[model samples]
Target: MDVGDLLGGNAWSYVGGTLLVLWALVWLYRDGLQVDAVADKYVLVTGCDSGFGNLLCKNLDVRGFHVLAACLTEKGADDLRMAAGPRLKTVLLDVSSRDSVQKALEWTTKEVGEAGLWGVVNNAGRSLPMGPSEWMKVEDFHSTLDVNMNGVIAVTMSFLPLIKKARGRIVNVASVLGRVAANGGGYCISKFAVEAFSDCLRRDIHYFGINVSIIEPGFFKTAVTSLEPLEKELQRLWEQLSPEVQASYGDKYLDKYIKVQRLIMNAICDTDISKVTGCMEHALTAAHPRARYSPGWDAKLLWIPLSYMPSCVVDMGLKLVLPRPSKSV
Candidate 1:
């Protein structure tokens, strides 16, 4: 067949096949380029009190990297210390506070000294009041943004000099919501900001030999995904709403909202959080780390594609799934 004939017949199939092959080759190449001397490296992880941060600290520590695990509570720090090796040190850090971040920076500097920091995992985040945007107050948005967005920027900026000196990695834990905006409230907005910030930081810091990676994970059954706290918060928000707003939404609407939230959480949240921490590991250790990593199957197959679809289509899909308010027009 001539080139024109081939292009006219099964062209899309050929293109798909070619792209798949290229992707496989790139994956193989990436797998082959991992850094050695892991024992000599130092990796600092934030929010190691639980979830991805806690697991990642233990994982990297086992692999021989000196891990500085930062937690918000002394209990959390002690728990991590007991769970991890002696090489794994725990520091109390509240990413939302400048004083806390600065203290942690000084501690890390003292620990690593002239060797510099090899990696910093900005895994501290919170997801709360994730109902319709109209249900949330301004403070609710600020609560999530303070931890997930501003915290990331503060910690990353504080440690950039050390990471640059070591020519190291910065892995920021965002979410599938960041790409797709599937949920409402500040969680998605903060994560979206994280993606933007990470992209800009990557480009700006590449000259310093610093690699920046953003981890976009799908629904994971971490504390952040717990339905109980969300349900409680929803109840609180409902109670706090003005009489007019409450009358419009009605108790039935609130009940349906909570039910749907619980259903979605149970159905989609992956219990095996290792899928996420594993990506963080690769971002820290790989010689040619990718700019973005989507760990969960749902993230790669579902939400990422949804994120790229037309806005109207996404809106319609969401509308179909969301519970209609009593006075919805």
Candidate 2:
């Protein structure tokens, strides 16, 4: 047979084979192991004031788990209490503070009693002053790291004994930024640290039957990704820069950056955050949970693939899309 005939005839075969493989993988993934006595399980979720933490607490409560929803403020706790059922309890927790984490641990220990904790969801995070690296102060990076990275470690370490006793799950809320360094700031660095920490923890505790799952979600309409707040923060950071620095990145650059940010948020951010919380739910309840879950179409299709691409290729693509600084080198 000629080259053209052979190529045309085999194309269909290749496509069919790929589809069959994907179907089989999906089937296996969906057919998770059985979970027993879900009602008896106790789960702790941080940052329950809003977003995925709040929704997950409600969902797990409805599913009959004893949910301990940790909020950063009294108002948040009260609001969560009103929304969740009677069985879902709320605690005041600030993961960045050791004293707060200790108090939360004491409360959670008392609440769970001998049954122990079935899961701990580290979902508390912050993203601020997320402009170019040149505009950031050391303190800005430290502040984000304290809340996002250190907080996760403190909370996890505090709850390890309880989780180990139940041989349960640890669901760390990372980001697609963890895999891809698309943004400049502590948000991406903190997430990258979380991914590494989860991997190491998983391997270390696997022998004890403790499962570690990392959730890498793309842009979602949560308080963390709120456009108004982010824009204000960017402006504040820009204002703090020295006059020389400000002149280097002119007012026009800042304006263009804000416009681009608004456009991206409006165009790409997923309003339905349930896609992320669903992954968290499955990780906690499934008998055999996955090590990692990348929710949202953007995460699964775009960011994840881009993360694996060559650095030069990724950088070129980023340059095309990202706004150029006024005095870019």
Candidate 3:
């Protein structure tokens, strides 16, 4: 080849290599940057019963951070307190109840004192009333929304002063479902709300030297992903439906729905929950925390990608996977 042509090709290759090296170096710098004095920093994580919340409490405790774990049950609190180090404290908190949240706030205020709260992981959430939207009543919807959406709002609003005092991080556990709708219940709706709230909160609180990170995990083997309770809830809703409604869907619909749900859960649910808690830890510890963290492979590979696709394409795919009603034209 002529010298000019060879030089031109090599020049583009050299430029590409330079750009790639710069990007990797920047990523490593951000990844390595962590906050100072982790042992003194106080971080409160909600929903520390038996899932991401529980795992995160232990993970942070091991890293020498002062961890405040909030569980809905006394047993859960006791279990966690037993497992964690002396610096890890547990509180009984039912996020849906105002009184419970208020009590927890007072306790946290006393614990953090002048040092302020470093991080707050709004992780408590429930997934139920999850079948077809028509099968659920207002009360069923309320049950999920009360804990998943309102609970986040209540906890965040109540603790803003402490968070502001420290000018720290607020890590919220949203779901891939938040970005893409694959279900028909308040679970997805609630997460979508969380995503919106976090976006608004980050903008509002950036002046206080605070940052907000959203954790959007795919299906994981947590209490939230258990099929037994979901199956029971589906049966309960089916029984409650009117005769005409039941006839329209036919007897086979419920079974087919359950089967499809089971297949999807089995296929996609990642057993290693550490994938989620790891993201949570980085969000809490990293000096330059990411705006969003999607942990599981399904999150990165499927749900997140689907969220960015065209509505018609997503709708068509959903229609293909989801079971059709007997009454459908």
Candidate 4:
């Protein structure tokens, strides 16, 4: 045989063999191929007005899951109900509101029943990335903490009995920022607390055959980042600063901050959100779910590595991206 012909045929054979192996693997895991198994399982998801909550609710409903989508506003509830069929229910639930949570629980138990409850996804979270800590107010930090951390806790506690009885899973939508610190002001801190809380919950509930999973998504084309309010907030933040701080940082710093923020927003918009949703589905229905799911390229490539890196190294790396206070003359 000619040398050229032998090399070409062998290379083609390798490619063909690799494709066949991949096809076989896909066939084996066909059931696990992001197909929702939420059928007849009543799941209560908080923050369903938009973002992951809404998306998950719609996706699950389409896949035959009985989803109880809890929204904060009437409009959100209406949107969810319209988008999803009768199998998907919409209720007004504010994780920060004790009364709302109590009412929602009663409604779910009375209507959806305890036997059908399979999972609870605490996907409702707010991120206020105020660039610099100094610029962030105490109230801003506390408010974010209340909604993100305290909110998750309240929902979990309220629904713990149902989850335990059903041996269901708890999916907490934490951020890669939680696992690895970021330049974000209060968001990272809140996520860190969430991570700790979820870990403890997992341990406590394991004996009861309940699983707790945390999703650390890098970014996605969600309303949280791409909305006009975020850009308006950044502009407002810059405007509200003291003259001394404003003068010191000037337009350059503000511009850089906005640019960086936009870059992140665009990246999130560019990536497929299914990567995050796929993890959410796995966390909910997988027989052997992972304790933590890091979704997206940024989460896998950057956040995970930095999370394991030495503290000093991580700090040095962060300093380059983050803004620092100006030096005195």
Best by TM-score: 3
What does candidate 1's lDDT look like per residue over 1-329, in tens digits? 79988777788888889999999998899776999999989999999999999999999989999999999999999999999899999899999999999999999999998889999999998898787777788999999999999999999999998998899999999999998887778999999999999999999989989999999999999999888898998888888888999888876998898888888888888999999998999999889998999988789888999999999999999888888888878
lDDT of 4 by residue, 1-329 (tens): 89999999999999999999999897557636442445657788899898788888888888788888999999999988988898888889888888988999899888666474688999988886456666766776887888899899999988889888778889998998897776556788889998999999999879988989999998777876674677677777777789888777655777777776777677655347778888888888777677999888878888888899999989998777655445425
Whose TM-score is higher: candidate 1's or candidate 4's? 1
The C-alpha local distance difference test score for the whole of candidate 4 amounts to 0.81
What tens digits encode model 2's per-residue C-alpha lDDT throughout 1-329? 89999998899899999999999998787757658899999999999999999999999999999999999999999998998799999999999999999999999999999988999999999998698888899999999999999999999999999999898999999999999887788999999999999999999999999999999999999999898899998888888899999888776988888888888888879999999999999899887899999999899899999999999999998888778767879
- CA lDDT of every candidate: 0.92, 0.93, 0.94, 0.81
Consecutive 10-residue window with the lowest summed lDDT within model 4: 31-40
* Model 1 Cα shift for residue 273 (angstroms): 0.5
The true-versus-predicted C-alpha distance at residue 126 of model 4, in Å, is: 0.7
What is the full ranking by lDDT, best candidate first? 3, 2, 1, 4
Q: What is the lDDT for 54 in model 4?
A: 83
| Local error of candidate 1 at residue 281 (angstroms) | 0.4
TM-score on alpha carbons, each prediction:
0.93, 0.92, 0.96, 0.84
Of the pair 1 and 2, which is ahead by lDDT? Answer: 2
Model 2, position 295: C-alpha lDDT score = 96
- By lDDT, the better pick of 1 and 3 is 3
Worst 10 residues of 2 by lDDT: 26-35
Candidate 2 Cα deviation (angstroms), residue 257: 0.6
